[model samples]
Target: MSPSLTLENIWVAGERAPRLGPLSLTLPAGQRILLAGPNGAGKSTLLAVLSGDLEGSGGTLTWPPSSAWAQRRAVLTQRNTLDHPFTAEEVVCLAGVSGATARAVLEELGAGAWAQTPYTRLSGGLARLVHLARVLAHLDQLDPTAAWGFFDEPLAHLDWRYAGAALRALSRRAAAGYGVVVAAHELNLAVPWAEHVVLLCAGRLEAEGAVGAVLTPDRLAEHWGISGHVDRRDEGAVLILEGFTEAG
Candidate 1:
């Protein structure tokens, strides 16, 4: 089947070097792709380009033509910069088709208790969950054919409980045929859910393939300068970072 989204040698212009990419990847429905890398790996930049907030200076990006770009894709960025004093429910309602759906999504994400709280007043993790609810609401309101959700560092502020809840929700959405892409750092919990993994290093795509194939000890060392063993558990794999190695 043809991909829902495609990037061909895509990259953003930089003052001294390319900001991101030369990445060529395709996203099909019901797939979860993990964008894994340390700081300055250009994960956020790539998400911006894919979500149509930023333009790439080179190459091509193609998406489904049936819906508006913003309607077809929902983005939950790292920072919650909405200065408006809207309540979490109101934010989701704006993204969702109706108030009831907004409330339902909040409840589903275990954020119902804070649905009336002002987004700015909530704790970092609570705020992130609310934003995620908004993203889910937006996509849920869209035509169910194929929608994409891009999350940048979603688990950064979330504790394990919230993180697990969010991951489970994303997994359910993927199972229901939505494309879920996350730029994440909490790998042990996420690796099992990811069908594909893209490793980035210094704004370059180091590896892109099935998670089991690409998420290896050798690749981790090469890209992250970490020497560790990958202990595969029944559910997921744990990356034990033993020490730092020189970047090859």
Candidate 2:
């Protein structure tokens, strides 16, 4: 069966060099994937590829033929710019989700009350939430059943409420068999929710698989420059990264 996302012979490049490879991978419907990596590992670049924000340097990145989410794939980046300062409501409206749907999405993100508030005047956290709501509204408008969600540091500057709402929505999408992929530095928020984990280091795939299976102590220490233990506790694993240094 064809997956929702396919990266065939993928190669990405940065200012310094090209990340050359004929990499092949697939992310199926109903799968929530965590793109994990140390700094400069190209996590953001990969997310860009999936969302069609940037063209890949080499190889082919294909979307599912049946559930083509070219427009449904919602991506939330850390840096969101508005050419003209808009109100919270205005931002949501741009995504083609106005009226009750927009109101509800903003309410979930705890920004409903700020409907008329100038988006430029909001705090960083609040602004991020508004942007998130906008993305959700877009997905709801385009094709909910065929939507794919991609977030690159969407949690950046987001408060607890927005974070919770964002993750909850992603989970909801996953349950509905949408391909949800997140590239984030915040491990705790992602680890529990992700069905699969892909670890990248220096532009290479260090590991990829189930969350627990891919995040090992050796890999963490080697790639992240931190020592940690992966302990299976109940249903999840805890990683004590760089804790030894703190004690010392």
Candidate 3:
């Protein structure tokens, strides 16, 4: 089995309250993990900690040594900014990938036509795709067996077709032994692609386990304050949300 990333009592402090943690979890290589929760659930904070962008107030995140870890992981945050006038392909090449490879990554995401387009000129969705391509391009140069990808709300600006394409690309990475972790709220879309699910509620670990085990209707109600059921189909299971739960 591939090695795993372990978090022990990880936490981050906030001005008024604990932003996240005291949460422990294991992220195994070659698995697709979905970090699901409502807004302000500390999903982005947790990803930042994993990506080494933010330090937790307490707890330890254990992975490979710093050197190897640096080379083996790629992160795509919810928001990206590039003030400089760089083309789409140039943005991807910033990840140390070859021009040809960068173009290929853009093409894979159906952004090939935008390769020479200025990043600042593209619409919100197009820019998001470009950033995602850059992240994936970085991972392409790593040892797949040792690689890890962390994404926060990657599906935000993508339409269904592109969203599916992006998920499929990430799934391919997992198949090649890259540990893929995505923080997202698109439960119906994300759940099918993930092998495991980690549900957070108000900065705490609400649940963590296999998708089938963690994403039940009752749990969704309790954690998401929603009314829903999991429809098990031959293809895969999907969350069917009916409405919000009435407040007590």
Task: Return the number of clashes found in candidate 3.
Answer: 0
Cα lDDT tens digits for candidate 1, 187-212: 76677668778888878888887776
RMSD of each: 2.3, 3.1, 1.7
Q: lDDT tens digits, residues 1-248, model 2?
A: 11467789787766667653445777776777888887778787777777777677788777633445456577777687775678888888888765678788898776789988889998888888888888877766555456677778777777666787788877776776667778887776677767789888777777788878898766766666666766667866565555543221
Model 1 steric clash pairs: none
| Candidate 1 regions with alpha-carbon error over 4 angstroms | 64-66, 241-248
TM-scores, in order shown? Answer: 0.90, 0.87, 0.94
| Residue 209, candidate 1: C-alpha displacement in angstroms | 1.3
lDDT of each: 0.80, 0.74, 0.87
The worst-scoring run of ten residues by lDDT in candidate 3 lies at: 63-72
What's model 1's overall lDDT? Answer: 0.80
Show how many residue pairs clash in every candidate, following the order shown.
0, 1, 0
Best by TM-score: 3
Superposed model 3: Cα runs more than 4 Å off: none
The best-first sequence of candidates by lDDT reads: 3, 1, 2
Give me the runs in candidate 2 sitting further than 4 Å from their true place.
Answer: 1-3, 19-22, 64-70, 241-248
Ranking by TM-score: 3, 1, 2
The Cα error of candidate 3 at residue 229, in Å, is 1.4
